[model samples]
Target chain A: MKRDLFIIMFISSILIFPMTVEEIFDKVDENMVYKNMKFTARMNILEYNENRELSMDIFMRDENNILIEILASSSGHTNRFMKKNDQMWLYIPNAGKAIRIKGHMLKEGFMGSDFSYEDMSENRKTNDLYNMELLSKDTLYIIKLTAKSSDAPYKMKMVYIKKDIFIPIREEIYSSSERLLKELIINEYKKIGEKYIPINILMYDKLKQNSRTEIVYEDIKMNAGIDDKYFQKSYFER
Target chain B: MKKIFLFLIIIPYIIFALRFSGEYNYNYYYYQSLNAYGENRVILNMNADKGIASFHLQGLGQFYIGGPKYIIPYPDNIPNYVIDNLPSYYQLSNSMKINTAYLSIYYLGFNLKFGKFPMKWGISQTYAPADIFSSTSPMDYSYIEEGILGFLGMYSFGDNTISFIYQDHTDYEQTKQGLLFENINNYFTASLFSAHFFNTRRIFNGFVFRTNTVEYLLSGFNIITDYWGPGIWIEIDYFADVEYWIQDSIADYSHYFLIAGVDYTFNDLLYTSLEYIYYSEGKTDGFTYNDILRRYLNDNFLISKHYLIPIIGINQGETISGEFAAMINANDLSSMIMTSLIYQPREYLSMDLNSSFVIGNLGKDFYGLPPIYTFQLKFYY
Candidate 1:
């Protein structure tokens, strides 16, 4: 009788898990659609030791998820790097010359930060890079993703999402070595342009370093037409 | 007359060009304290500087984008070009005077310069791999002395250019000689003098299917002669007594270094890079009058920091990254590794943090090198 009971419980768990996961994902996809929207995001970085804190502003739009503009404070002493399509340029006030960065040099540290030229870029395609599998349904849809890109920095990721809102609750980034490098949690969500989007994001690292980054969105506008000419690489040096 | 010529020749083009740009930046180890005998003061701070600028031609010329000039210090005891509208730290005193000029032109995919200008030739990540030969170094942030007064030129051949050059005079010296007892060698003879033949060539290729890599090679011959030496003030003698002689035993040196690196783009938002460097040793120049003065005045002061380095970095999307760098002695010196991470929320704001630790056996109770840690907050529009 005990063996029969265990078999019945296992079969029921498997049958219910897929049904709930599918229902949650269906709710999420209902909100995430291709549209034109404009939004602003703010983030704070806390460094280890007795170092100071850092902040940033991010502006994003989804035009077929094609173009994105990221204007960051380069450093305290200079202001520069407005470019598109992975090309970047920097203008130093003191030198009086605008520098053009080509190829891999753009991948370098942005002011000694972990963020790179690619990090501050417009790349949003979860399905393209990951082989997704529905794992379980707790309060949200839980999915496990395995990277398809062999050269990817992370090997695998587990994402937690809200069933009703269809927004991610948390994501853990791992190294190829499977060591947990960073964990990102969405602390707050705001409804904008008929969709629930993350308004506040917090990033923490597993390394015993006293560094954390918080991103807060203040003013968000969506689907305003912006000229394509503004996103050109030539605009960076100009 | 020269100053007016400079304004007429150099200022026109800079004023005419226009641009618009922005950047996301972070700096780790903004400030790390050193543990010492007394209350550990801010002995040294993690000095990280990052920023971005965009420019718009307004239908003027072609558009260019890249990193800006991060370090440009004002002239004090050092001598170089002065931007009239910008701030300056040094002013002419009653006892000293400084004058300098350089003609630089960047056009037609080439950067050419004649007269005094800044030029770097070497392979190094921390200390220059070709320390003995490379003129510009990481430590020389002020860019004061590296701008040799000579004919310097760089051309991009098929998107890049490599060439050989020769020059005289590493530092400007008085054209006239000083006299002792109303009769001595002329001031021009007392000036600093050096000569060199340098060859440098770099090629950037492999932009196919979103993967790019660049390779560079640098070689040079550096010769220094007739440097400033300490002398005794002889009220009665007719010639300045050369006491601390540096000229007689100085040897001309030759050095070479190579740098190779590749940057691969896995996708629009992910990138990775790896680099390798090699160096050959050569001769180093004389110590400054300050060094000799410190030795006589007190017994302890740093003379110089010279070493070799290797660096690596990786980036994921717009908010996460990692950088690992190490500098070690050519042969036996223990290595120093520094790693950092950065986070940017938006265009106008960002943050950075980094940690540095030592590897292997470092002699002494505590390594002269302290662990590096820092944080930086940035604001730019």
Candidate 2:
């Protein structure tokens, strides 16, 4: 019991001492809040017991955190989108029409993870649900997060060590049922401009199936002069 | 001790899920009447289905060419007797494009999804055209259309992935009437109904005097690589529903369903699945659309599709596959035999031939000849 207390204090010292959530936010440029960015990326899909396949793409993004258009390998099979608040629209090249999508059917698989449609959007914030408690320190700070609501997506998320010089090292999420569903492991990090964002993210879903996804970013330009019109409905049609 | 422990283990999880979860989807499908059996007919049908997974966009749209074709040849000739007619069968055009996109951060055990995808409601698996198992005739089924919107919550545990899906029930309600006609309105559709709002309208004023709200529950999990390891799936589903509508003089009610299945890969050349479902239709208020369509379509096509089912499928490499599904009931009057042969000519193109026959008085008479046959050609990128 005494040992347990010492361990807990040690964890607290690492997480609470250097960087608070507000401190991390303060470092970013306020003007960067809504700038659109463009990037080229190599996307890899790896499922349990499956081979890893690759897809290449050039993506357009807005500062508002919207994924605007994806030019997939040239041909018009590529798709585009416009997202604002609760409304979303898609442009299909073959159909020659753009349609609106709405309702609760959004819980299906995305690119093939247990991740649902709603899991991919930019909404809510970490402070909305979690009270992060520091756990340890080395180069990274380990934190323990408990949910504010019983129905919160995760009962607990053991976010890996967040280092001052790099993006998060690893993260483990548990269901209220206390089951581990997925793991995100970041192996490589590069300093882009002023911020050190994760250039590569590897996600593994535990439903024990052959479903995993890896996204590698390259030629990333953040807070470049991009227009909101780039995220407009017409942009998706283009 | 074991039973109490089990209860203790499950109760908290249930409580946790009940208090927190929500989703919305826009599911849409169009039916093209391709064949006709008796008097039911649709000359052309098309559909569009849209959805959000997590909160991103997902969609499937297609057009069809034929209609349902079922016909009974009556003795001698009786005027005004449409009992033996077949509906049109619509040859479906390949989906213009199936688009999937999302922007949620997915890492480790937690998935933050924000896109579109379908909810597992109606037992029909095809994006449109309904389940080949339940349709009165191929053409009688509705084609895929509509879409859903909402976010998704995903948890990855051990070797399993658990998903808590909450979507607005309104869109699911739009399919309730169609489900009633299809007789698939048991726990599956009923649970979808639990998420719907019902209202009574005045024709002249277009006023909704009252609106009813319902609750739906869905628990889905898939095990990929635990004990059995990758390329394998062992899942069991238990779902329930409750509906409350004051204007229709409807009382609150609920029902339950159970289904379990496993998918496994053998060697590098074959994949297979064995699934069993135990379903109860719950309280039937006599002649729902399900009953009417059942009798109408059965008389015209000699097919009966309501019952418990066990299914098996085999996938050989990437280009060839087959499936067989049989329905078992206390009375032989309701059994089914179905099989399909699929061959992939290329990575992007394939062909299939399928045959389905219900074991009614008519199908039993044919010992040497198969009752139904279907041919299909497909292309995809």
Candidate 3:
């Protein structure tokens, strides 16, 4: 009677409910996006066997407002970039006024790295930009995301999220023309409070051979209260 | 004076910042006239921040070496008296300058700044008519500025800001004052400014040189926007009182300068811009040596009525880049064409190769000068 009871209990556990795409994505968004956050990061652009490094501090308010202050640069002088809603501006130090930048400029490599300005600005939820569906699930859940808006940065993306952690481990990005443009591989996840954050990321430009960028995220603080003034136009002008 | 600047730069690096940071740059030029020269600059920088207050400083020591050992003889047709009076073509020794030394303090939801800093009042890229505080060089993409010494006070509310600036100059007759108002909207930024300028004039009194101060009153408006597909900007400045010497050409006439430009970048590969400028102080008839001398003294270097500037660039981001730009004087059909190539191999090292050529007749604008080739290297620590 004990052996029959054990077999029935094990079979009942195997027949549990599978997570739908919406449920899985909602979890991913909860673990990833935050209303207010701050982080320090470094980027290494490998070229001709030489590593060009840049360090910056990023502040985000919601998903639409982002400001990046370059603390150290290979080019010497300090500069800043602010993205408010759909508009962007590069605030060159000492030049006084901020110059408005356009959307096409977003595709440019950021500080000569494989990460474009578009990539740095992608702190939004995938549900808003893409229509996601579950492709397959084994050790990892392979999800397919198709662009919902024509203005989306990428045409399609394939995100592979860990089943247990619900954090993305790899992403294949496609260009607007449906070309395989970039591949991002994430590693070294750290548990901070109730969330798992990826600290190490490497991106490769598929069109260019031996072109890659390494990014390290550090000192991340989530739900941090920052002065609302920092997101205002006067903050940059000052 | 040099000691004062040195003391100012060093004291801050010691008190405000523990780390001493700077840059060293060397530039060499060889003109088609077979003359060669070089310039060396050592820049020191410091930054310190605690709470709502911050201190920032940058100082430069530049040494110009080589070039024509003596002044070249002017052509017979040109005025040769001034050339005869001058001893040398250039200054061979180095000079020290304080580029920026400002202390920014925040209190009571207001902003205050003291000391020397760059006053960016113009929205135009290549030519800024509204930027009356400093001159912008056409070839300098870095926007190297000689910031003015002043006191700035700012107050911001909502999406608008109002600022008042005052500068006292020992060489000027009266203090310089400016009031600026700026508003930022969803798609565009607009600003209106009014200012009073006092400049110095050095006149020879046979036995000695005397300093005389002149005045020019100005008001301007500018806008920068990206709502359109391309970046577009416009700047306009109207002078109620022109400089004393410039009044001879347009006596008691209201002078106006207008500049408009559009720029676009295609991904990481290409960048392009075009600008049109119109200045009422410029002579539509022609220019003489006396006119050129007066223009040089007043810093009104653009001597033509209408101008056009077009630039094209190709880049692999900041790794490797090349640009070709031209400044055309519509009145004379003469132009200056400049091209540059830049390469940055490592994080702290960069090299630039540049060249410029002028096209015109002997007496036309931008004429009789040889093409200049330059190579520059910079190191940052």
Candidate 4:
């Protein structure tokens, strides 16, 4: 009788630990957020039997500022994008001046890729912008997140998180009209120090025909003491 | 052609050692004038970068086919004044000139550059009062400013920068020195610039505020705001002690120019912008026709008291884009409309087709100008 009781208690503790939706989001944010990081990434865009590649260097500070520089491209090169707070600026080497990109332009695909500018610029804590609810719990924890504000790029997202590491493995993004717009699949994960990072990502645009983009991250350095000057506009002139 | 081939041969060696990229452009222009002419131009641009050092070079070749008698006039001697106003392309009836050649070095937080390069300033796209380094030509849509021969040094801090330029005009025995300070932020950017000219015969001898023979003290302020949905920009330029020759007499005056513009994008598919400009020193209804001509001869031409410009752009996809722009002269009711289409089949190759038309009554602004059509193919690697 005591063995059966112990078994029932063990099963109950495993199933009914009483984890809140907010706690799950907080755990995910804690595992994914970084103070400052620098990385080089390559994007491969595949569409209609054609493959295009672009390489870029990225620097991020806190959660609100980011600097992206295109290192090499088959097309024109030396393009830069800087995001500070809510404002974003693009500098084209030919124009030799930085132009402000308005909010509506954030939804457009970046450099003709499947990733939108908003997707590239989003560095905020997920809990700050999304309301989360537990959907199911199997080998992975499934959660549905809805944007807290209308200004968000996607209205809803269904995220599948690894139950052990609290890292997202897959996500489905929905448009404002509740239509599936894009699917993001995390292909590979690397554990650098204490953090688990998704190093390879595949994005598929459901609304488009035979269009997909793959991002591979390399030379990633976290907490590398990047200078604050890198986020300033004066550094963009080069 | 031999020199160009040799230069292309050296590019491969440089690419193996460092970062090297170049572009070749071929364009054809058709002008609808009384003497209707066609011009074909081929330009090559090469750039190399390694560590703290970089180099840029541009070469252009032009061939004129069936133009008016006056199109390529051969003179005994090319006047200094003509050379001063010559396009940076360095086109002469007999010889070709190197358009741009520059080398730059960066160390610490300072950048030092030498040789000839194109420098552009001011917030307005079309007419910028603060663009004292280059002149805008109404006949071409290329927007290629004449390169300046000079040495430039710049130092940048967090959000602030300071720059100094020493420009030399050896042929005219003159030099210009300028200092500029700028600060930039997420919402706004501002700058203050001052330039001094030496060896200008018309101005007071030593350290006079001038660019070339013209004496002027200039200051500009620009503000950009996005507190609202769309973005609004305001720019103002103040010119103090501007000297102009009126019927062989030099006169001094002060004036200010103001520009206000707003831009917006809808659904990430279309972009639109509207801008208005007001020039305090422009010829208005109060000035007679001869007075306008005198202003034109004084190096201030085609500037109206008021101007309105509207621009629209459509991005069909990654391969196609189109733009339409109209510049309206409020005083004379004249307007210039331009339509352009760009097709990019590959990442490094593109083709562009452009057409421009001018409409107004005779003797009015933009009316005497002829329509133009252009087709260009660009390849970059």
Compared with the true structure, what per-residue lDDT tens digits does model 1 show for residues B298-331?
A: 2221222333445555655445666766655334
- Give residue A171's error in model 2 in angstroms: 1.3
The ten-residue window of minimal lDDT in model 1 chain A covers A229-238
Output DockQ, candidate 1.
0.03
Q: Which stretches of candidate 3 lie over 4 Å from their true place?
A: A1-30, A40-56, A70-79, A90-114, A127-157, A163-166, A174-181, A189-197, A204-219, B1-11, B68-76, B81-88, B139-144, B199-214, B242-250
Q: Put down candidate 2 lDDT per residue, B108-165, tens digits, no spaces.
A: 4454433333333333221111121122333232333333334445544332334444
Residue A141 in model 3: lDDT: 92
Better of 2 and 4 by DockQ: 4
Residue B216 alpha-carbon offset, candidate 4, angstroms: 1.6
| All candidates in order of DockQ, best leading | 4, 3, 1, 2
Query: Candidate 3's residue-wise lDDT over A1-238, tens digit each?
Result: 9999998887786567567888898889877775688889988888657677788888988777888887776555566788776677787545555766664468767766888788887778878889988989988999999999655678889999998889999999986677888899997778888888888899988876677898899789887775556656556655
DockQ, every prediction: 0.03, 0.02, 0.31, 0.33
lDDT of 3 by residue, B5-76 (tens): 455456656666433468899988776665777788888776665567666777788777776232332322
Candidates in order have lDDT scores of: 0.40, 0.41, 0.73, 0.70
| Single-chain TM-score of chain A, each candidate | 0.69, 0.69, 0.89, 0.91
Docking class of 1: incorrect
lDDT value, residue A81 of candidate 2? 51
Model 3 residue A32 lDDT? 79
- Clash number by candidate, in order: 68, 139, 0, 0
Instruction: State how far residue B85 of model 3 sits from its true place (Å).
Output: 5.6
User: Model 1 misses residue B205 by how many Å?
Assistant: 40
> How accurate locally is residue B55 in candidate 1, as Cα lDDT from 0 to 100?
18
User: In candidate 1, which residue ranges exceed 4 Å CA deviation?
Assistant: A1-38, A48-122, A151-153, A228-230, B1-381
